[model samples]
Target chain A: MAIFRWGMHFDPLAHLRQIQRELDRVSWPWTAGARRIGGGTYPPVNVYESDAEVVVQCEVAGVEPSDLDVSITGETLTVKGIKKPLPREEELNFIRRERGSGEFTRTVVLPNEVDAEKVEANLRDGVMTIRLPKKAAGKPTRVEIKG
Target chain B: MAQDKSVKVKTTVSAAEAAEDAFSPLVDIYEKDDGLVLVADVPGASKGDISVQVDKGVLTLAAEARFDVPGEAYSRTYLSFEPGRFFRAFALSDEIDRDRITATVSKGVLTVELPKAEAARSRKIEIKVLE
Candidate 1:
């Protein structure tokens, strides 16, 4: 039996099936179950505030500084890079692949606005540090009250 | 969290033999502001134990993965990435000052800074005014 409920609108079931098909095509990382597969899993990152700057450090082993791309807008910072995989033998068999590799992107939300124009990024010894100067409104200001 | 256990995994090579080919030695050349900075991933290595040797314009770096952290003997499995030996080598050109090379290691990562030679470095020259 042909089921047609709406007169002209698209079928609800068909739309849902199409959405599911689209979702399956997306590459989702392994969060809780199954083994994750990839070439570049982003390294651990740490962000903290100093006297005049917010410093962000990221551990990017096996990656060169030239390959990193950093961009900031408003109060958001994004670090993207690619970690090329080591050349492997054609017939080498692997039992488990724990290290995720390929291209990785890590986005961080800052607590306050930053001076995107004066931002500086330095990478040394597998660690990339980004120094962001806080904006005037983002810094702590002293308020005086007259009685 | 998984428990910390150190188990002796099966490797085709023995301990003494494995120590020889512990880490792969190769240098990655890169360009920086002043000169070139080479970053080598030498896991399980500590400061004051690694050496960067440059002889006849060829740079050879050596470092080992020596760990003292004790682990409980349990059902432990190891893979090829379980911190063994670290090694890397690179070639330098006339652009770099062979005597000015500096190396520092922190958190198992080695960074070698090769400043450009005086003649090779870019400098601003002042023009003399004519009478």
Candidate 2:
């Protein structure tokens, strides 16, 4: 059996993970008795846009500001960070642990053209907010109708 | 490697609470020398809005998770998550010293320390050698 592909490497884990991601997405509506302990995406984010700017709000609780890196290129915004596990994992007797820890990077495509220079990132109470102001061309302009 | 052990701990959801559909934040529980430490991810929940309570040998973590979003939302092409009330409850074993439990919230995480009672602590007996 050949696992080779034209331009992509054969990664079984990634494929399985993609399926699992879809399964989790389907369960989003039903919130009954589901622990949701298993890893979904880290730093869950909310995106909304206004006339002036488009903002992305992310949940980064327990993650340090120093550990995070946010960057944008074209229409994509990437957030990368490391959530260090509790100190001395082996030493402690864990009864239960659910919060997953490791380096995670999530990239999102912005809906509107934004002025990257005006982008502002702020961290407060473990939440990260990134503001991307709309460029002059990106903003909507009203035009007069011709007779 | 330690993940939330949903099996060992017993939990209950009242009908009223179930109707509310609270988000169960991920939690990690481990034992230290003196007590057990619970760390939970409750992003966007303010410190004042979180409530840690011990009643009838049950420990409950509840929080009102409020978030901030700028401007009126347009027809979003992509979305990830929603903010809601967070609720998780655990049946505390007798070994825990409920009176001494303390908690703190930082950023969007909540850490709770549940100390072990004096009688529940383990001690090693000294051995004597006679020449």
Candidate 3:
């Protein structure tokens, strides 16, 4: 006999996100040359906000630094790069392939303004970390209360 | 057989009993001249924290991502990070060289190399006539 657990708290937002992701997959244009397997984006990213700076980390294993391009326009930061597949013999056959390769672009809008000129980017061990300093106007101001 | 016993002792709970937060990492496997290479993306997991073990023809990958909470709290636009353990297992065939297997982790990616056994490798043979 198998026991199934029910009444687990369900998150509607999570379900919506899953539906959105599925829609994005099916809505992709098929006419874009040879259909790429597991195609959507090459590298996924995470964004963190602090009082001083906005940090963005991208997972880009096997991607060369020279092939990456990072640009910022207003509050949006764009990361573009190409992940080249590993070279193998012509007769080589893949047993399983889940990683996506080719060109990918990810544009994220920051919640607050940032100083684009002072942004710093570093790539280590395949992970790229970009730190953008928050603008003075974006910082939270503390107002003094008169006693 | 001794190695297999050790593996069983390490993992007492079955896969079905694992925590609900556990997630599977994305992996790509390729065949090469020497052997097969498995590349997995395990973001936030450092090289020292990741573990790769093989026992009884089964290969298990386990790792935990370290998350550092900042001083101040703020709202997030996209929250993808849910710190927890990443685990996966795969059964190997007899053609693989179990003893010669090697693994390395870099930039949050783990690469496992499984070499083929001597009898499994491809080779060319020449015919000789008896004089």
Candidate 4:
């Protein structure tokens, strides 16, 4: 089927500019920022590493450890999980939806080459941890004197 | 804009609070000699365990910050931490050297150094005219 090309289509650049403006309108936090939780809850996820492995830890309160899925292949590591939003009835008075829900995929590239065969992942206390072993080079290097 | 196909039970809060909470992490873009330096505020993120990824022209970052406060004593009255997965994505242009992009997180702050292509970096040239 032939597609219709109308010259009056909205400009993409203008739309992008509008999106930028809207993004700017968003209220931003500073170096130290946090939010208030109505009920008992934890904080945002934090990721870090150690001498032995490149570790990733996420604070997924109210979420079971079994719900998380982590995969690592070569330099790419993916963490896809779900956070079931808190349930409430009796029509919300009216406000905003800040928390992101449903499925989430977080992929990171390993800083150094890693051994895909020995990668390990663990989850406990609503925190998911992924450990990747660094690839080891065989044997130490030796130098010979030349005349 | 409100079209509801079904009624579902969910948490309902004020719009203003939600708006303020949504974009909690503020990202700063710095243009340096290397390329673009992105410093993002991931409050709970630690230097040892932050994830930075670049695919095609898209960049994604996620981290987890542990307070280490034992048990219920750390009851949050006003938790600035969103207490969930933090995600951010940026569509990069040719200005970024994807292969050379280096990222490091220190003290809950993430620093990403996007190196510029060799040709894109500014360099001083000597103009010598020979007869």
For each candidate in turn, the TM-score is 0.39, 0.76, 0.70, 0.37
Question: Judged by TM-score, which candidate is best?
Answer: 2
State in Å the error of residue A7, model 4: 62
The CA lDDT at A62 in model 2 is: 83
User: How many angstroms is residue A32 displaced in model 4 relative to the true structure, after the best TM-score fit?
Assistant: 22
User: Candidate 3 at residue A37, lDDT?
Assistant: 22
Sort by lDDT, best first.
2, 3, 1, 4
lDDT of 4 at B115: 84
Model 4 CA deviation exceeding 4 Å by range: A1-147, B1-24, B69-76, B128-131
* lDDT digits (tens) for residues A61-113 of candidate 1: 66767779999966788898987653452333432233335788877776557
Q: Which candidate, 1 or 2, has the higher DockQ?
A: 2
2 or 3: which has the higher DockQ? 2
True contacts kept of each: 0.03, 0.66, 0.40, 0.02
DockQ, candidate 2, vs. native dimer: 0.40
Cα lDDT for residue A141, model 1?
A: 75
Report the lDDT tens digits of candidate 4 across residue range A1-147: 112222233455888866665565564433122333322222333334434455444555334456677777666666767755334313332122343345666556555567788887665434455667667755887888899
Candidate 2 iRMSD in angstroms:
6.2
TM-score of chain A of 4: 0.52
The pairs that clash in candidate 3 are A125-B107
Report the C-alpha lDDT of model 2 over B1-115, residue by residue, as the tens digit: 7433121121332333442457788899998878889999888887677777777788888877777755355434335666677888788899998878888887788888888
Clash totals for all candidate models: 10, 6, 1, 27
Candidate 1: residue B15 lDDT (0-100): 24
